[model samples]
Target: MAGPWITEHEVSVVEDAMRNGWYEHAYDYCEKFQAEFAVYHDRQYGLMTPNCTTAIHLLLAGLGVGPGDEVILPECTWIASGAGVTYQGATPVFADIDPNHWCIDPESVEKLISPKTKAMIVVDLFGNMPDMDALQAVADKHGIFLIEDSAEALGSVYKGTRAGKFGIGSVFSFHRTKTLTCGEGGMLLLDDKELYERCSMLRDHGRRPGGPAYFNEEVTFKYMPFNVQAALAYAQFQRIDELVGKKQEQLNQYREKLSDIDDLQLNPEPEGGINGAWISAVVFGKSHNMSKHKAIEELEKLDIPARPFFYPLSSLPAYGEMIDEYKTRNSIAYDISERGINLPGAANLTGEQIDKVCDGIHRILT
Candidate 1:
């Protein structure tokens, strides 16, 4: 059988939910899922949304981050992080990342903060949490909001605190590829009761305190998820610990097999921190100058599926004019973007299959 990533259990649960009319109960499922997720993260509140992007927008909107305000984000992340700021009419000020961990550098972030800066959207890249201690100090000193984009770090920890619990508000993705799969869904976790209430109203089309159609209110975008997705998400959340354990096992196996290879550099986990290990990444050494296209082709030829890391947010046309100014000087993110590749990282791969995948990389690089 092919080495597919999704588990049989996940498939079964999703199918059962679909057959039981769970999708139609999206609103109820969302409420339940939100409560469960918040409890899991030890957060005060949680809101389930259609996707992570919308969750981000909702957070920014709730925070009142709009025109004339600047939001700091790492230049190395996916465009979606920057897009959320743009959607709210906030200027995105790109900052450099810590080359070793591939997360935003707190020192660099401090250099970029200006009078107009309103928030810092710190991303936990590749499941590695940013240096939260440093970032928290900066946000506190400046009186600015900190938003944790924990889309890739659902189970990751920094200084013994979970990812979602660190920021004023945080967003998590439950997409097909995450450690926990919900098909397509997201959640926003926050501690502030007022912010949570605002997010709920905004997500539900600006519904007032009363029931539907009883009171009129300002227009707001509808970004609620269907109950079916929430049902699946809730089910997945119940098994999160098991899923994370399998992912950790897989990561250990990959590290054991490939750590000694001279031409490849594996993703590094923070000291004394637990990473989600959602995706295992490898970067070609400087001597190889191996382009992502060539590396991907070699892996494909060996029946191993690998993908390049996301293009730098600065490289996209939507933010082209700001690229030159925002590109961090001498950051490894540039090199990582060109040479980094994501290995198959779903939770269901068998030990033998993982060996085959590693063996293919060893054969190509050695």
Candidate 2:
């Protein structure tokens, strides 16, 4: 009745882990989960962290990104993307996104690259993997590190390669809203062995040889997740295929059912990628004559949960002036942010519930 978003299987797994006192097995569970996730995405290594933000921070630090360095990111993504760069004392250069796919535009990325540009974080926003080949070319040309923030793209694939496998380092989130939910967890995947070793040491408090118990050998922070969370994450990973399959089916249903509405526009899968369908998004076309905020309010009144898209980082107070000079103004990223809305995309939503949500939008718009 409350329109639950979490799967019943996930709940059961967590409960069982708690009851059986198996939470202490988190380290072992996380190790296996990381290995499985790496193999699933065809990556060489995977390191689990507390959340995606921390994972991104680890990757940035591991790559030696620091003050005077710049990391390129889309202006339209969650603040965490930009915050990760800032956490490393590296300036985040906001780039506009592709109007069609809502992911960072490769051309825009190239134009923003400078001598200070040290890395680029290409996010697979809304489960859609961007043009990695094109982005990779830009990064390669500039000799900058590329970190794929696959937080919303756990199961997404581009050009026959998985999203997490594209860059030198990548991160994934297991938040409740993601396709894969561990309540609160994240992972860092990388190809370089030395980077992985450094990330592990950093996550564990920089514990070095001569340091005290559980202390770091190098300068690091305690970003590790307890074993309890790791057990739940491992159990969730076991059902990832099932969960992703259900979300994809739900996306197809939404696409078909909402097709008749002329004013509503649905996001399509990328040209050569398979989306995880992490969240189903729809935009009111120019003809809708309704603001995104109004639509969200109307949907909420009808008990159909819908949320407005993320605000561009350039508009935020903390980094507003800094990013304003990055060519993000008057960009497609701003346009998409204003127009987009995320519909309830939980795997547990039944067909009737989805129909109710669609009907609510139709009623408000038409």
Candidate 3:
């Protein structure tokens, strides 16, 4: 992956972190970023974590979802989504995705909800929000939490509302690959102070902050993010709008450059939402002579990096037990996973670079 986009501010804060001491008690860069980020998403609380996966784990733990309970999630997400559920010893029931947006289908999510279901993990994959209105309605009817795994969607929006605000809580990844990068960090966004406090305590060894001296309330994971990482996040967060706009420019470039390629199709923009412009992905026509793997290999040979979409949960060995269970139920996810190709859409990429990448694809196919 490419390095994170950083300005002089990140460098200065990191230098100050070293001089002032990262272990200093009064240090507040991390907290500052957390507060700013929370406001950016219109949430009341935000807690930074070491990574998105651990954030999910802590969120699930805080919500009291564990053994014998179930969390419904789309079958075509990064493995970390399922890993989070497994961490709680809860079953991750797979749901099909809408073929157009490649996000969890609300109807499929409703079908998967059982008495044992505790929540629905809706992933805004590729920076697109699923039909949150519909998904939230199902969650309300079932009295289950709607947890948005918005790891790939930081600045996206749906029907005028921010992407992370639709669900009761949302998680964002600040990994280098994301539009906003801190090199490595994650944030949990929510309006519920009780759940926020619960997750905050769970994030840092079950200790509740009592003035400067904290108390150990219960047993929990030690998954706190470093102030150093948050400093980087602060720097990147400042340029979030520019970063998102740059990628949107790249998205437009890719759409224009590859419009004539009948066998290669770009993902659809959300009907009433904005994309975070994470990665410009395409789904190759099934009749193409070049397989997805072959296409990736070809792109590699031309010095253009490309990646296949995540393998559907039904096909992964890690979820073999659930594979058979989800095989018939998640056909759309399976089909989309096999065909989707994630093209590079980094902000620093230039128009020439995008054209070169698209040209490489055209040459490989022709």
Candidate 4:
């Protein structure tokens, strides 16, 4: 699907970047994407990174979130969200999620905050934005940093505000599977100039911000986004409305076809803002007596590429030692992970393809 969207403009942009030579200067091309992306999200600045993981890592480091600090995270998210906190030598506290939207519950977040808590990484998973307005108020009252991991949600909005605009720093991913693709890339959106400057330095081997190049100030990885990818990303960004619309259409097809099946929970569009995402997901009810694994296996046999939702943080072996501290008893996240499956909602997936996918699900469930 990503392949179909590649226009000649992206190729020409890459070629132009190549002719100019990235070594001598990359800021010209990269900065254009960053600036344009910031404007799109209504953020003050945007810093491009190698990926969202690195974006969150740099965000944590820039904000001085480190050893002995604690960052509360939604229990069900890509491991990167928790790893970002781990990289800073901080504890990753886990909390339950709201069953309806599968986003971190604000009340759960408030309960987890303590003197050691410095921030909360709210994941807008599968294009669903949580109650950021409620969560932001909690953060403001407690003075904890609110970080939005909108890596899976690019154009998703809640209460008329863009996903990444609610926090001190928010991340967006442009991985091949993401709504926008640059093969692999990320963007950090924020309002603070000082924080932005720190992120810039951390992204480029700790150079003293600005640049004549080759002035290393401290130890940092090469997290900078390449101009070539940036060019490709900007090209994809140009067609965002078309891409989002196509996904929403595909989602509609899934719901219209599958919604009649009793005991099958399809993705819900809780109206507050434009929840026009097309993330085709289904959670099997207790009566179905089928595990998500079995559904995925059956889908694969039919060549229907389905993905499982993330295992709750406590459910995974990686977070074994901290289970007692972070685990919430009878977590809804764990229940959702056990039952949910994500079908292919590729930006370029054809109506025929979506139909086949839905037909396969209907056959399996019945």
Per-model CA lDDT versus the true structure: 0.81, 0.80, 0.83, 0.83
Model 4 residue runs over 4 Å out of place are 1-4, 21-25, 211-213, 276-278, 321-330
* Alpha-carbon RMSD of each model: 2.7, 2.7, 1.8, 2.1
**Candidate with maximal lDDT:** 4
In candidate 3, what are the lDDT values of residues 5-36, reduced to their tens digit? 66787799777765674555333777888899
Model 4, C-alpha of 213: deviation from truth (Å):
5.2
At residue 54, give the lDDT of candidate 1. Answer: 92
Model 4 pairs in collision? none
> If scored against the real structure, what TM-score would every candidate get?
0.91, 0.91, 0.95, 0.94
Decide which is better by lDDT, 1 or 4.
4
lDDT of 3 at 10: 73
Tens-place lDDT digits, model 1, residues 1-366: 112245566567567657764454536667788998998889999988888989999999999999999999987887777788899988998777776777888998999899999999999987878899999999999999999999988778877888888879999988877887677888899989998888888887788534678454768978888777887787778788887787778778888999777767676767878888777777788777687888899989999888887666776687864556655552555667788888888666779889999999888776
What does candidate 2's lDDT look like per residue over 1-366, in tens digits? 212245576577667556664545546667777898898888889888899999999889888899999999988888887687898888988888987778899998898889999999989887887888899989988899888998988678887788788889888988867777677889998888888887878888786423579544676777887566777777778888777787788888889888888866676777767988888888778788776788888888988888888777787787855545643453677667778898888767889998898789778876
- Better candidate number, 1 or 2, judged by lDDT: 1
State which candidate, 3 or 4, has the greater lDDT. 4
